[model samples]
Target: MVNSITGLISNIQRYSLHDGPGIRTTVFMMGCPLRCAWCSNPEALSIEKQLMIFDQKCTLCGECLIVEPEAISLDGGLRVDRALIKDIESLAHCCPYDVFEIIGNEMTVDELVDECMKDEPFYRNSGGGVTFCGGDPIVQADFLVEVTKSLKNRGIHVTLDTSGGLPWDQWDKLASAVDLILYDLKLHDEKRHIEYTQAGNSLIFENLDHLAKLGKEIIVRMILVPGVSDDPKDIELRCKRLRQSKANVSLIELLPYHTLGKGKYTRLGMPYPLGRNNEKDKVNVEEIIQIIESIGFKVYYRSP
Candidate 1:
């Protein structure tokens, strides 16, 4: 019956170095509750299968138009009315060239477990295991719980990368199942948090507090978006909150923002929320690191 539990996933990246402790496999689960302005994995944000068109690969073939004439057009080039398209998979299949790609895949718990187990030897040798990330793995908490349980029974380490945006009750079972948590602390101000991520931080902070009380090992990851999340005052305040909560924060990781995902938005035929000029110089990395270290927490940052 465990084989019948299916989850939508965007990708399963293997041999990841930065996701967790050792060489690990990172499962990019599909779907998220938050719509952060600087989201890099736009394809994983939605829980449904989405059509990703690579305009460059298109050869102006009218085959796709024949499949869904109303949703596709070859006027000057390739044009897709994504909202009007049905049978996305069929439309993608109609393309002779891989100009069309599907973003998500449905995977059963047993299938996912087998895929992770393929790297079990590497996990054992490197102290690395499977790290569940996404649009936020908590979005598919039930499926994750079963998968993690199967993996745990096999002695594999599991990590949950999350924004903690959902209510505790929604993902408490999932939180208990993972060996470690890679928690994201994006913005502290509730109003500003909602403005940037389209989600409130109250529940996120509450869940962090709960994780702390449960003695869950947490590594706080903060993406240092230049004009948005780089405010020293906000960073300091966030650290103060983390310190006050006595969250078992292993360390703080400062991730610099990049425009790598901008192209993804284009492929999905969706406007990148952050404009083309959104890439600004990151705040002084040393200063940001010092700020976190000053609060009695170790810091890790990889320059972009």
Candidate 2:
């Protein structure tokens, strides 16, 4: 997709089980400025350099060698070693099969459309389509606009998974191109939001308001984080705010926390804040669904 899409990406998960409606190909983008404490995608936090290792597939052959001090045996589809991968990055520059490779790659809009078009037939049949996911689509707004436009031009359904934290000026270019936006609302309180994500969310709310007014197809998403986002009062407040936003968004998706990305941070030499076994309640999902339904909105159970 580099020749067509103008940005870096790590992987294109084809026929993804969950991400959006149908069997979607979730394009995992790179680089996000936000440092949300509860984020599972540690790999998407930075664009500079990253290291990843699959502990399950490691052979422990002990033939590892890499550029960074922390990196070991991540150069290629090689024999594995029991070495720490933290503090190593130069190792990724020499890989052949993406062993211990970075998650994002650079591509152009034309190039992305060209490459993604390879799966057109599958999308047509499975009610599946392409989903632009990342730290946030707004991080790469320009590329997303062109790519989504191209997809629309060719009669493909386009979905944008974003945090709605971008400036209104940049968003105007993408409004018409995106068919649906899986708008992620992190925290409603300015100070608490800043404290948790290290970034204020006033702009996020403003953008949501604008998008709702525009009457675009929207699905509101909330990460059902345990301590960070699961207070009953907080959920009610969020609900109240949404009731007042008057945005056109009608669907709600509840994404509960999982330990899927903690190992990513370990390979990158970063501490896993949630750590393994930091469990969150699955029971709250019913309550959340009830509340959203009570508000007279349709809700998708998972991240459809």
Candidate 3:
């Protein structure tokens, strides 16, 4: 019998080629420890259920106003006091125009496994399987372990995409369960990392060193944000650290920053952290690739 372990899920993206090997069904679990300034999926940041207003779809029917007058107002346009809303879930149903949407959904272990199993044929044909990602999957480690175990029992290949911000014990068990680990290396300096992500790199680095020594397959993902993380020296420091740790790294994937998820902040009634001013900020791909390759690591980059 499958246990009734439930986890908060943000989205289950199907047919994704960028996450891991082959075509994958990336299960994005809710909640994260790091707040990357250039995060694309802002909805996945919070552990709690958040309301997203689609102002374009809203007919201004005034139905949602009846549910929470203080929270919902139509003074000039659709104005939502997100913090003031207590019954956030109720607003999702109250909107006849389907304007309001709740970001997170609860899924039991069995249900999630069943959902992933739907794409088993694709997984087998394309050498792909389910990948557990998140705001950072480590936030829901316990619940995901059961889900991963259930999937593995069904003969599915599993991958974990994480920032490695949590402690060792949390990653140890899950690392043993998954086949591939997509580890993120955001910033080399601990103070800058704290300033940007609101967390230190000490625990993350320690966990990476430990994971590497365990001989686990790891693909270090580095997101290049022009002003934030695009420094050559910092990148070199990260590569040197990985080399020093003797990490079992298959390759290093360079992810470029984009304004794709900026609109999500507006929907969630939150300010876009990096703002639109940096939209034109570009990264020197050739320079970054040269640096990583010179360090004796294979590189993977998809042109945007």
TM agreement with the true structure for every prediction: 0.97, 0.82, 0.97
Worst 10 residues of 3 by lDDT: 273-282
Rank all candidate structures by their TM-score, best first, as comma-separated numbers.
1, 3, 2
For residues 111-162, write the lDDT of model 3, one tens digit per residue.
Answer: 9999999999999999999999989998999988898998999889999999
lDDT of each: 0.91, 0.71, 0.89
- In model 3, what lDDT does residue 33 have? 91
Find the candidate with the highest lDDT and give its number.
1
What C-alpha lDDT, on a 0 to 100 scale, does residue 215 get in candidate 1? 90
Question: Which tens-of-lDDT digit does each residue in 1-304 have in candidate 2?
Answer: 2334477776777887566677777887776757777777888777654567654555544434534434444355443342654433444544433455655667778778877888888888988789988776677778888888788888888788887776777766776577778888766677878877878887887787788777887788888777677665666677677878887776777777677777677776578765445464444677777777787777766631
The pairs that clash in candidate 3 are none
**How well does candidate 1 match the true structure in TM-score terms?**
0.97
Q: How close to the true structure is residue 226 of candidate 3, measured as C-alpha lDDT?
A: 82
**Model 2, CA-based lDDT:** 0.71
lDDT of 1 by residue, 57-157 (tens): 88986898788989988889888888889898899888899998998889999999999999999999999999999989999999999999999999999
